[model samples]
Target chain A: MTDTENTPKQTALYDKHLEAGGKMVDFAGWEMPIHYGSQLEEHHQVRTDAGMFDVSHMVVVDFTGEDVKSFLRHLIANDVAKLKEPGKALYSCMLNEDGCVIDDLIVYYLSDIHYRMVINAATRDKDLAWITKQVENFSVDIAERDDLAMIAVQGPNARAKALGLLDAETAEKVDALKPFYAYPMGETFYARTGYTGEDGFEIMVPNEEAAELWDALKAAGIEPIGLGARDTLRLEAGMNLYGTDMDETTSPLISGLGWTVAWQPEDRDFIGRTALAKEKAAEKTQKFVGLVLEGRGVLRGHQKVITDNGSEGEITSGTFSPTLKKAVAMARVPVDIGDTCTVEIRGKQLKANVVKPMFVRNGKSLLEA
Target chain B: MSNIPDDLKYTKSHEWVRDNGNGTVTVGITDHAQELLGDIVFVELPEIDTEYGADDATGVLESVKAASDMYAPLTGEVTEVNEALDDAPETVNTDPYGEGWIFTMKLDSMEDLGELLTPEAYTEEAEA
Candidate 1:
């Protein structure tokens, strides 16, 4: 789901999804498809072939002005001033004064005075408010790209399928884009990044072109994936869903996203830096870990985790990995906990071993490490 | 959508009871129940030989979306539970009325079968 179902928001591709027998659900604030028929089959399609996802529910905001980079340096926890080259992107979390996560976003440096940010739609209101408040004194203007729609073409053959739909010039430029890189050719912007833990491109184009582009990609043999497979794919990839894995009350340090934080350039002042430094010094109680159930039963969120070291935690995100053929979950446990824990499933305690994440990537299990 | 065999009795809660005519009954969830649940992920059926009341929670059925309790349709002593669910719970999604049958029980009170819904009534109620 991309938008909250209680609301009336719908993505540009909503009709197409429904036409294809998609099961609609409320995500963020929009009605989005969870799947077409079998979520597991869609999950397998992405791992083995190519799949396209409607990610237009995400908010794309463009910042233009002389002080755009300077404004972002104060708005995000990462050092965006370090992004020297155009078309380079950095992943960072915007934190509040209390050092809690406000939202995780991707910032792309388009030029010295232009930047583009893609943020979760669920936090659009608050994110806009926060950015507006910070840019008051800076020479920058923030504009939301409501006219744009995003589509993620993922899996092993995703690039080939996407390239087949683009013009020769754009295809050549897109072909040269490296991971964490983006390039704009005409009205379409293509980024060589995805959330599926697979190689792919995230294409952003005008709303009118979205449906046509999706149709072209489908014609090129890309499967139309829905939110159900998206969830399982990201879970298997060890990627965190914003609200489920972390929220306004949780810090990124304990949310299995510490690596995304850039701690260098102590002189660089970003939002929540002081509090994060203090928390870093004090050391937190929570630690995120991956759990694989050794016995029967599927693990799910809110399930109690009893560690061998007398520590307790709860599963934040759990699902049956289509790629792994077993139940896997991400849990936030006490920092002192050992490598093994027991999950309480239907009154029976099941043993689960803890490990680092990235359970599956590129159709291969990373759990062996 | 699946056909509820005229010979089987159903509970409003969606469990189907098939009479074995030997003071015993086979039990499983209705096809409509499985369709609403999408994909069956896990099932926790009662152990064999367990004594249960007519309305007792005999087991649990978990899907990718939610978890539901399977209620006993009649007072009985459990004789067997479907072990195939341990490997492939999706059998319930594929064949809810036949191969996905949950358990069998020896009826302690045969009169309880009269309180169960007939195939006709179950269909109308499910549709409504």
Candidate 2:
């Protein structure tokens, strides 16, 4: 048996990847496709054209109860009451008692009693355990949907291609779906969401229909992208990977995710509000920033960042951006550090310019330097 | 994939050793190694005149994905290093067997070549 079979999981499109000659790699305990052929070409395709990714490995958890909204308001760091529209989605981080992030997720409000969440695959077990343990007091039902498969179609022409593959009724409903919005068709759920920083739709379908939908999308000229391109694309777009950028041990303020935290409604109580409020009041010591290597060499994860004062931080995630043609990295450094720093690459310190991330968005350069 | 010339010997770690007509050998990473690494971004070659054993780590290859240490295929004294890699590191991924050569060395002894695998044997080992 293959490694994927030995595990307790397999994505619906696993066989399709094998047929396309995908190079498989072990990612977060799941066997996943790294690339089909040239990872560089795959990266370019998503930046220029349309591409589809089988993100079924990510766990989808559903919640249903009369007190669902109240439960979420306390369980998440962000205020979910802001999602007034039925199909609107809210991006929030589930934090521990100490204000450290457990996992960042998107909560889709379907109705007063129904909601859905998408969590990272690597932290599936931890996230499920945490949620299950906390739901004991609430009259809520939590179900892990292993029977569903998620396919993300992304790029400049992603919406058009995805619309072509969907049924007429479903396509019409999704045609005007705004960003961060989702609606359910007969059996498939379509969300106007993506990680590549492009206009796209993420479709959640039954396991039996996933392969057919994937084949239809491919026939419609949507290229199949693997995890290799996914990483570079997200990095270029300034999106954070859960484990690499932050984890249960790191606070959102220091990991460049403070924007997702909602501190409004002062009377409202959330899981990590007290700790976060204290940290914010005291003026934290750490901050997140982007770094671009001014000289030669690729900046990668775990590389040390040196300031004029001394070594002040380390790279969280780094990659040679295909769109920018230069190495870009996200690093956590002391809040007092300046714009210029040096990255220790292979024992030699190379000068780097610190800047706000989002280097590329919508096929354009967002960085000035 | 290009044919691994019969004249050269290989190690399971993917290093190729070409026995120069003289008592020297040219060492470079194989094509399979470069392909797996995607794009070579940086390479750290050993200092010239350094003596290394057949199993010693003599160099390092940093690709866009990960970093790997290149081992000395045979005992030798490093005679020349590929300085061109300083600006054109992608040569290791484009032409790993030719201009991408890491370093040349004067062999300590030619008998150690017997321990290396033939092209066919090396290919099988890599596929495994």
Candidate 3:
């Protein structure tokens, strides 16, 4: 973290991003591309065809030990026991003692004793410290895989394009990979999971092999996407951004992530089980919902929302959704709020319709026309 | 470097001024400004016939990245606005200097143009 703070670090594909006409910007201490030429076009490219994103800035940490599963169950809010098979993956939120989310990550069960976890770049340092501290009584060794680079290939055609890069036998095996599953081939790891709602793969390769893979992807007619479209795509998919949608001050229950919390098997205790149980018993005061602007103007984060009954809320993550061709946002509002609300933008109140957080999936609008 | 038409005047806020030669002047964000703001998605233009002081924030140009305020180059009365921009704000990104013109205004005085920066001066500031 100290090293990343001095200057913006570059990913292994930095030159490739530059050659692809990427406009670099400082994102979480890394010089990452915001877009190649047009953010809108890159967004459409992903929703329509295949697009690749250099997500090497995200930290990949590996955990291995005799008690790995037990340690994970105690460290994270979700149950890792749900990963019953090798190569299975689970999405969970690591919570603090007060039941607030520390980070949301994906953990892939590689073997009986080894699990690989990918966390946000911005929360790298604290997440490591927290995970390490929780390993006190367990026999676990934590390793941050800095030598690995991650690339997410997404869209309807993403799987076929990615599979083409593998040998026939390997392609056949990966072709049969189920959702929420992963396969490790030699040094590279491929997961049939992604942040985008579209079907795709999040592949991890050696740092030295990243540019080669990126060139191959480009030659295969996969357009390179940037962080700008990545944000919009994830928002449309109803995926929560770590710092923007929820952080240490917010619990997953009130953040529209209650489904991620494993509350069954009451005896199975996790880090924040007590606090979360207390909150559940007390009843949630706020709820998360989606907002679609009824008129013109883009919805953006930090905008205030006023319910019909005068209760106020705030937009968490928002953007001009290219797929929907309208402004869409996720907001935390009064639990009893109705379907209609007003978003305050640039001193004017704009009406919005509230619905489920998800706006689009698989290049199709989920909202009724 | 962004294109700076030598025939036009500019402001430090990145608005370009074109002398229409009939006591009216056309204004829009400079190419450098549009490049910095990125893809423009919405434009909020001031109403026609509205009066504005020099350097007043007259309108807003919202891009996919963020929103920026377009300012008045000199004291003027808004005579007309580009209605096309209301539906196709992306013209600002594609043609910031031509079809992207935001509004036309009647200048309070022709002498006010002297206070605006020349193309060379603007280039120095924008490319610095």
Candidate 4:
């Protein structure tokens, strides 16, 4: 994954990244910035003030047809019927026949006949194919939005800073937007959604104007962050990375995403309903939990987890939390696991405190100090 | 380009060594190595008196992106490890050649210094 045989593709802000001294790396076959200079500094900037990210690599898919609502309800694990108001968003896992997650995505209810989804960058090819295959019985037209670019501005002052770029009326309308909702102001669509657990807007703009908007945001004092900080921020926010936390072979029920499953109105069977129902009824099932290392050395992915009850598990994702000044991890362990366990880091047994998956939100630590 | 001090010896694995004029020598990763590693968050050092063969893994350095093994530049016995790095691993990124010196070792043989790479040779290899 580190090297690429073919030339990697670049986004609309490629030149802008180079001007900012971004260190480019091959991410999901695209040339993306890993950091401008210091990842820790960029992370702290986003947590304390405001920072922007070029997230244009993620695919934006739009579905338009009379059957959009019904099609979505049958496509993803979440019940899209709950998206009653236009511009409302639902986070869901698109599962396969065996009730295993294919990709986790956000779907917006634009209208009864129109919907939009934003999926992970790495899963582009497979996700498109899967969605196309499933739309065979519905009257939906899947339109992949390749002509657009996405930029996320996040932090304590992100919203106000972003709003400063807009006209008064448009800014007022955007400011009134509820969380998980979006509104199109002129050519740009603003969503009150982000991955960094900070108050912000994820704006989708035309590719040709992306650089101008980026420069404007830079002039407004929002630092340009890279993928390095994005990973840590999302991890600290207790959100799951699709490929790392769960994949095609892992069910959402055991992936710490059980809350995303909408099991109401039982007659509306989604793609993985039967298998998921069976798993939900099963007596013994492993659970996804968070771990805070209580010893030296950084906890990392694939490290062995030994529960106090003699059960075993593995860390799905782990890193040294810059905010907490300690190592934190998300792991899959036996349901009977207790409050604490040991992690094997290079043949050393290090104790760790088990807690709810979330560690931080909106610039505040959820964990008790 | 990374700074390559004329007086120091180098290893292909990126460790730079300073001969202390005695049986002991100080060692740390090069500026090029630290730049490649990015924002280092944690570091693990070898215990004093631990012996290792030339090219053996001696310690661990972890950055936000990944973890890397710090190899011994020459066969020696560990004399001291930088305790300051226990709290400030970023020192390696900020000043790799000074206070960030990872450890000092008592050489098994002073003749081993002849096998090390000079500034010119190290510059060629590093740029290549």
Candidate 5:
């Protein structure tokens, strides 16, 4: 039986996840929890209260030794020079030479000659290989830290409760940490960042300490979240998910990630800059837009979108938003598309309104286009 | 453990067919089916008066995980659909057997009922 099917990988907290009534599913080859019970409840829990997620499957890589800044400056679409302080984190999409997204990651400036990057779980092998190959003669050393585990505590009251599990000083430090910042207190790395569009922290702890922290969080009333809620929460927040929303063949410009590209300091060239410039000069036809289904049926990934002008597009990520109480999606449509379009679900066409990609932030609706 | 009612007939594809004792039969997903799909978000029912064959996909049930086909258990024409599911898909997850009935079909023939699996046989196949 084992030979007939490929077994999914388990993370450090796999047993804890199963113990909490988590329904396991194969996600990108990892045996991850889809939900403990209701996905909608978990989604609401994160928005209204506090919840924790075992996101340990994502890979963490560190760069050390001389000229690391220069190496990163040329590697990612966003400028590493933007990171000025220790533990400052910046989100960027690493692109290939043809201007397609290789992977979207957060790079943390640990110090002058050292930095850390966290990438998606599914793209680990290729992301590492790409970074390794590009570091040929640079004086930097690459270290993939598989020894650490990542846990995200998110929601309105998540930070205050997460502090209850840590030391007082650490709690104070966490309280002071600004959004989009990362700090190391003892062996734990706490970053005030999350994909859920809520006030929260993504904490990285040693593998041995992960389960204990999770148990403590659970004991303190922080709910254990699964990947099922994670997808809906991120979709409601209008965050882009890798592999689904954008892939190696899709450019960041058309994937709702054009804002992440830093075009200033025109002389500082990065990979795919020329291709992106050429695409920009030619006026890229496709653009990213948020779609809210105005009629029946669920709008799902790959559903055909028809603009008012008869142009065609496709939904990259779509879900039923629990907060907005409607079906919403992120789609790549023609630049000429108006504020509303039609989506073909099953055999019928349903009207949808096109808006900005972000639909919610900080537990409130950011519906303004 | 998933519930398998002894009185209802089941399809290998996870739908349940109940004999209404009249000329028609009521169709819905089983308890086991709803658990697998998780929190359902949308249900697209077949049009009234639409016809379908045994095991034909006539509608869709969508959850956060994916969209699955709601197959017709036997050859029949749809007489009524679960209109409540248009706004409340969670009925399928909360009450898969009762309120979540997908559609009712007027049978083409009493002979088509024999194609369905017995509850005992269905449990074995589903478990296996």
Candidate 6:
């Protein structure tokens, strides 16, 4: 194989990942760490103590210029104007005309004239084109800033460890920011938002300075975690992934994203509003739930869930939860299904209890005793 | 390069077989296979009395990343299974050919062993 066609693109922290014994894999066209040594150990590390991740592959987009506030109001499903206080962030899904989710992103309202967003790396091209096309008439400029590198320091003790890496003055500025908020450190940005179900910070720094900060954090005992544990952690947290949980053909209504849609304004008719209304009235819309396997077997993606009523649904994402010591999965099933169902594995059908898509949060199992 | 024992026969699917001289053969995954699967969490071995044809999928092995089925190397009847793996699946990753032995099957015929790949053949095929 030639050098050019050899592998996917690497992030700025590629060296650091290698130095930490990370097993690199191609994920969404980006070379990312899947694990350092053992995925099970990494998963437990985040739950008990602290860990860090190289999330530089995600794209950062900035929307600036006049009337930016009004332009974003019609472009996205969530109400961007809800950020009455600057630095407040909103989680939203950018939908197509048919109410299908194009991508789910986090929007940081820095000001009325400027707003920033973090989009999934795999959906970068489509999301950027959609944003550029939607702002045709509005006086807003879409600038895709690829020069920034992102790192997520997550877990119960993550914030304290991250604070240890920075100087006193910088740490004090970060300590003042509340959850779901961000603080600008000159050109650097730090937000209290994360995919893992833990208290942590998602820091976006200049590309050149990413390695130094990662090394500094590593020195403080914040081990480098990988995408393998990242999946189980987010799945346990009940967070929806971009492609596995939902995609262009799937709606936020059936894909566990109905809450992100803004329906209050009554006048802010965003894209896909009509189709979303039709879906709300339809009885055939699929429902989302979590399946906790009660029998022997690991729940895997694309498995069929057979309800007691004889209806079936498909699993969107599934994995072995390290914390719970059981197989858990997110499934989209018929609305009339019961609180328990059978997951078809191999030639046998296994029993699994149905619950909210979340299994663990804040280092505690949410499942009832 | 992983450990490919000199005396054991190999399957292209990565299962290793050893003749116990009592007409029954012991079987487990090779070191190369376990390395690819990485820290196996679960293993599903066939029942003790189960009979299987050559190349039949007897059971499954699962890791954190994915799952794969284990295929029988020859026509045989399972005589015993590794009971220790029920609680400690990591044995497959730690000692794939020793304590991690999956099952022992009495071969229908000794001639069937000749059809499996030799160590030299398997090493060349796997390294390729």
Who wins the DockQ comparison? 4
Q: Fraction of the real A/B interface contacts present in each candidate?
A: 0.18, 0.35, 0.59, 0.82, 0.82, 0.53
- Can you tell me which runs of candidate 1 are displaced by over 4 Å? A1-7, B1-5
- Please provide, for model 1 over A145-244, each residue's C-alpha lDDT reduced to its tens digit, 9 standing for 90 to 100: 9899999999999999889877898889999998999998777899998889889999999998888988899999999998888988999999998888
Better of 1 and 5 by lDDT: 5
Q: Against the unseen true structure, what C-alpha lDDT does each candidate score?
A: 0.88, 0.88, 0.93, 0.93, 0.90, 0.91
Instruction: Give the alpha carbon lDDT tens digit for every residue of A1-369 in model 2.
Output: 374455645588999898888888877766788888877778888889899999999999999999899899989998899999988999999999999999999999999999999999988888989998888889999989989999999999989977886678877889989999999877789999999988898899999999998899999999989998999999999999998999888989988989988888898889988998898899678889999988756788889998888857999999888788788999998877788999998788899989996788888888783
Worst 10 residues of 3 chain B by lDDT: B61-70
Cα misplacement distance, residue A307 of candidate 3 (Å): 0.2
Looking at model 3 chain A, report the run of 10 residues with the lowest lDDT sum. Answer: A1-10
Residues B1-128, candidate 5, lDDT per residue (tens digit)?
78889899999999999999998999999898998888898898888998898878989998877899989888889999999988888998888889988899999997788889999988997788
Question: Candidate 6's error at A239, in angstroms?
Answer: 0.6
Q: List the candidates' TM-scores in order.
A: 0.95, 0.92, 0.98, 0.98, 0.97, 0.96
lDDT per residue as tens, model 6, A1-369: 254265788889999988988889998788999998788888888898889999999999999999799888888899997998888999999999999999999999998899998999988878888888888899988888889999998999999999887779989989878999998888789899898898899999999999999988888888889999999999999999999999989989999889999998989989888898898888764898999999767998899999998988999999988889889999999988898999999868999999999999989999998
Worst window of 10 by summed lDDT in candidate 5 chain B: B57-66
Candidate 4 residue runs with Cα over 4 Å from true position: A1-5
Evaluate residue A105 in candidate 4 and report its C-alpha lDDT on the 0 to 100 scale.
98
Worst 10 residues of 6 chain A by lDDT: A1-10
User: What does candidate 4's lDDT look like per residue over A1-369, in tens digits?
Assistant: 344457898999999999999999999989999999999999999999999999999999999999888899999999999998888989999999999999999999888988989999999989999999999999999999989999999999999998998889989989999999999766688999999999899999999999999999999999999999999999999999999999999999899999999999989889999999999998855999999999667888999999998889999999988888889999999888899999999888999999998788888888776
Error of 6 at A125 (Å): 1.0
Shift in Å, residue A248, candidate 1: 1.3
Q: What is the interface RMSD of candidate 1, in Å?
A: 1.5
* DockQ of predictions, in order shown: 0.52, 0.46, 0.77, 0.84, 0.79, 0.69
| Candidate 5 C-alpha lDDT tens digits along A1-369 | 363258888888999999999989888778999899989999999999999999999988889988899999998999989999888999999999999999999999999799999999989878988988998978899898889999999999999898887788888888899999999987789999998999999999999999999999999899999998999999999999999999999899999999899998898788899998888789679999999998766778999999998989999999888888788999999999998899998778899999998888888987763
lDDT of 4 by residue, B1-128 (tens): 88888889999999999999989999999998999999999889988999988998998999998999998899999999999999899999999999999999999998899899998999998999
